[model samples]
Target: MKRSTSNQEVKKLNRNRVFRYVNSREETSMPEISAALSISGPTVLKIVNELKEEKLIREVGEFESTGGRKAKAIAAVRDVKYAIGLDITKNHVGIVYTDLSGKALKHERVRKPFKYTQTYLHEVAAIVRRFVEESRIPKKRILGMGISVPAIIDVQRDYITNSHALGIYDVPCEELTACMPYPCELLNDANAAAITESNRSRTCSNLVYLFLSNTVGGAIIFGNETGIVRTAQEKDRGSVYMYKGNNWRSGEFGHMVIHPEGKRCYCGKIGCLDAYCSALRLADQTDGDLERFFREMEAGNQDLKKIWNEYLKDLAIAVDNLRMCFDCEIVLGGYVGSSMEPYIQEFRNLVAEKDIFENSGDYVYVCQYQQEASALGAAIFQIEKFIDTI
Candidate 1:
């Protein structure tokens, strides 16, 4: 029985590997998939035929050959399945949809102020239904939907333990999303954004994603692990997992105290990183326009310049602390991150000044997906579940 179960697992893994390889590329041949995945030709052919029958892959055309008959190019049927992600924030609701390719096909942000009431939840459901209809994707094609919110999630019980952003507490997940017409799940906004960044690259397995939006948050991703549970580090590249802590409140970087008696935070705490380093620190100075703040600062506004300087100093402290704890790449994400290209070098210098291990700040970088990242990541999370089954 043990051997039978192990064999089943191995075969499943091989099929998953082949599909993943085909899905990741624009076009690939059977020979290339077999060689790259180190699978026998016969087994690769069997899996390819199985996937083809499932309508998950199709032959695009024939590849130009170096020899005999040209190899047939197989491509993933990306539209075979779809998923939706909803990002519920204090003032806006972001909606995004993705296919099996795990890329956001369409996204929209609506200006709907959040209220902790049953009416608000109903409205959220209404919007989701309208979004799906407008997207023209059949509801049956969507595998699942993920809702991203700025809150501490209890994955075991499936509820929001605390959320300062919406001023809610002990809210059941069903209470927040029960009105939606599809399968629903909850994801921490920062963690969802980190998932978006993770999908952007296959090489980076470990990273500390710092979300620098209105309310700062973070997510830690570990790569080269055997599975979801922590185990002996695998030498070969393997699955990546998020460290959600024992209580599922792992990446609360915003609350980390950077000073003892500094500014007060909305969470009724003094010297919190969010108090000084959040995107609001700069955006508030420009009537809540983050882009205008950067524009004016670069346009030689001395007042904004001084504020920007202080913001970077506080940010450097938090980033350095994260580096010390995780010792991995630090990805700056969120609203402010979109406009960070002009000032990344300057910010890196500040972080480098505090580094004791590395001389250069090469590990720090801006995120790839800037807009609606949390929403997109939430959608991709659902896509991952379907891929795993394959």
Candidate 2:
């Protein structure tokens, strides 16, 4: 019985390995998979046949023959499985449908103020159902759904511990999941963006992602996975961290006190990073129009440019502090980060002025996905789970 169990486990591992290899490559032959994974040709052929029978993979074409007979190539059926992602923020709700490869097949956005009321929950459910129905993909094909929010999540309890942006706390997961048909998961908005970025590229393994939207948030990536960095004191922390003692708020970087006697934040704090770095702060400079603010700055509006320069100065201080603590690449993301692409060089220069060691722009990078990252990342979380189960 022991030997039988071991054999079964080995077979399952090899099957998953072959499936992953084929999914990663554009197209591959049985011989190629065998060589890459160091599995025997016969075993590779058997797994390939099994995957084909399961409709997970299909023969795409035949590889060119160097000599003798040509080899048949196989590729993963990307649409065989799907997942849904939803991002809920203070001002908008974004929805996305993604395949196994994390490609967004369909997406929709609606403007609505977030509320923890039952009416809001029902509205969210309606939007998700509408998106699924319009996608034209069979419901069963969608493995699960992931919900992203700008708040601290207690994964063990499946609850939102606290979210200053939404002004809600201790909300049960069922409040949102009960309205949906598929299985649902709750994730931090910044963490979701990091997951999406990690799935998009494997180039940088260790890094920090700063989410600068209406509320400032962040995540740390170590060895190609999201992780938490421990700090001795709350004052000496970044945007995200594990709570120590009775403290429920740990990684809230936006709430970190930057100016001991600066502007007041919505969290009833003065001189916080959020007060200086959030997109809402920028919009306030131009009568609540961020676009107009940037437009004026671009047109040589000295007053607006001066306001931007001050904002950059404060931002540089916060970014430099984080860089010194983490000693890894920093990724700027969210609505504000996407817009900063045009002025990335300028921002880098400001950061360089504050850094004593590394003055190069190589340490900082703009995110690949702009506004869609959080929603797409949420969907990707579900897709990853589905893949693991398979």
Candidate 3:
């Protein structure tokens, strides 16, 4: 059965939609918001006044005349609140900060290996405090912080279920955030990175992001995040919702078996995609330095070239499988993906050979944001949630 909303609910929804429109654009007019959102002119006027009183938006100058008195130009006060994002990997921590514009204002990476202990958690919290202090952003202006971890995060339960790379399972969410100064939330690193990828376009899109890091990871993005509330089944909040499965373990693309009875995977499975396509497989050849591996390959190192050729063959299999299942854009992201531009065409040719529905591999793409994407995406989650409240 479908549920109906109250009059107050409808009004709030309309107000939120109106504010989102203003925030999304550089500047918009009252008449433009009315027509664009299908709200009455008086209703837009009232909402504009309400937002102005709340100081979430400001009326700046006016638009050119259209055979009538000029309309006030309204824009969102993007700096009213800010958010910080933390990306937790096996051996490094990536941090990024963003405002309403949803772009990373600044980011930094620190080398910090994972350690399961209360003391480590406290140190991580201190790291955030130091970063914020260095940035000189007022504490009051910060809304909250989002932590992107390499694990299956139960957003509703607020706990981490499993993280192969981190060597932990079923950890309480508080262990990592209990010592933080500001409110913090957890997100799967790949899912968080996908949000950053989608935000790159500044438009809603349905796509799948294939994260090629130490351990392979993936995430799915539904088309509409800020769209009107049409269904009661919406799970993850704000502009980008993840398709977490029944066990909250969707997009586990790494476990897919590409070559049965072949090489063993770290998860004790044979021939899982992770065993074949993880960036580590190639980086391991160059003493764990992925950049050096690429540089050596570009300089025509025959041994590295042989390894890359085999790696791309395996990557093509995974890329083709993702395309077949999602039928949307497949983005290669993470450590190795940052360096894939030089060989994407060659890899695409391999994917095209396996694809039955399409002969072109144009759908396969390299990710936009690199190491900072997960952290930035995690911060955007808080930013979008703040926008929803307005």
Candidate 4:
């Protein structure tokens, strides 16, 4: 037989349950929590009072009266604590501070490239620390730090398997996060991107996220509650799945050999989709001048327009393939996806023309959060985990 729980254990469990119940609802009353947990009215009152005293919850308003006394409404004070999410990229590092709701209060980006030195880690850590200190939140209330990086991460092992852009090999991400006051967690950028997309588009039941930036990444969303993205699940936390299969590399869709002997890729491959469809490729098409290309596109330059059309065709094809494979919403993200907003309809129309699906025009579209997605996604990941523990 299972050992009987002590009063203290029961109280702790009930307290956590009450807190979670309140936080999950849009608005709730003390009596509602009491009824749901089958606890005494006085006991629920005591639990809620403690949470309010801790500044973790607050009275939002009053509920409609039922021909008697009106009930006071309560909701989670997400700002009582904050989470820091860092998106470390090769060319830049995006740092953001957000509440439990994934609302970014303040954010700043450092343009410096990744340096494999103590200086780099220190610089990133110091910026994050300063942001936290300025938020005026107590250290104890702060949730753990979440980091998103475009690398092969083994979160269980607390180390990065490989980061091509940063030239990192088996670096312990936890070690760097430990320098901060709160606990640290590492996540893959693609997985984080998928989380952002899922949160931004509530209507999508399942998703296949494609983040095509300087490097390519992907995420798979199974439903609202589950982030089926390979790197986000706890069981695969410390495991690294190297891309060993032919015709199927993890998010290295950018490096696919579209042409037998085309432009060389950074990975020493030829005719890479990245070589043909990336922002860098677009810039190269304009003779290494991004400003000129953008300006020309804006000015309705026929040549640039033609090039963009061809590039977007390749992107649409990629999306079509992902949709066929996952049978879910296809969300495009990253800096390039942000700029493609005005052309979303055109892209959709082109996909309709492809007619891959029997319905023809029933293809999914791009993400809503756009550029800030990965950072916000990293923050949401922490928030969801924290709620689960509660």
lDDT of each candidate versus the true structure: 0.89, 0.80, 0.87, 0.71
Q: What is candidate 3's lDDT per residue for 273-321, written digit by digit as tens?
A: 9998898898899899999999998999999999899989988988888
Ranking by lDDT: 1, 3, 2, 4
* Candidate 3 residue pairs that clash: none
Question: Top model by TM-score, which number?
Answer: 1
After superposition, the stretches of candidate 3 with alpha carbons farther than 4 Å from their true spots are: 1-3, 225-238
CA shift of 121, model 2, Å: 1.4
Once fitted onto the true fold, the runs of candidate 1 whose alpha carbons sit more than 4 angstroms away are 1-5, 225-238
Q: Write the per-residue lDDT of candidate 1 for residues 1-390, one digit (tens) a residue.
A: 353436776788888888988998999999999898888999999999999999999999999989998999999999999999999999999999999887889999999999988898898899999999998997778898999999999999988999988888998998887888889999999999999999878664689999989899999998663223443322222447789999998999999999988989998999999999888899999998988998899899999999988888898999899989988889999888777888899999999999998767788999989889999999999999889888
Worst 10 residues of 4 by lDDT: 235-244
Give me the runs in candidate 2 sitting further than 4 Å from their true place: 1-10, 35-40, 224-250
What TM-score against the true fold does each predicted structure earn?
Answer: 0.95, 0.87, 0.93, 0.77
- All predictions: root-mean-square deviation over Cα? 2.4, 5.9, 2.9, 6.0
Candidate 2 residue lDDT tens string, 1-390: 353436776787778778877877789999898897888999999999989998999999999999989999899998988899999998789999899787677788899899888899888889888888887878978888999999888777778888888988898877867887688988889888887776676443567788888889888766422344443321121112212224434346787788999999888888999989998888988887888989989999999888888888887888888898878778888878878888888889988988889666567888987757998999988887666655
Considering summed lDDT, which 10 consecutive residues are worst modelled in model 2? 233-242
What lDDT score is found at residue 278 in candidate 1? 86
Better of 2 and 4 by TM-score: 2
**Top candidate when judged by lDDT against the true structure:** 1
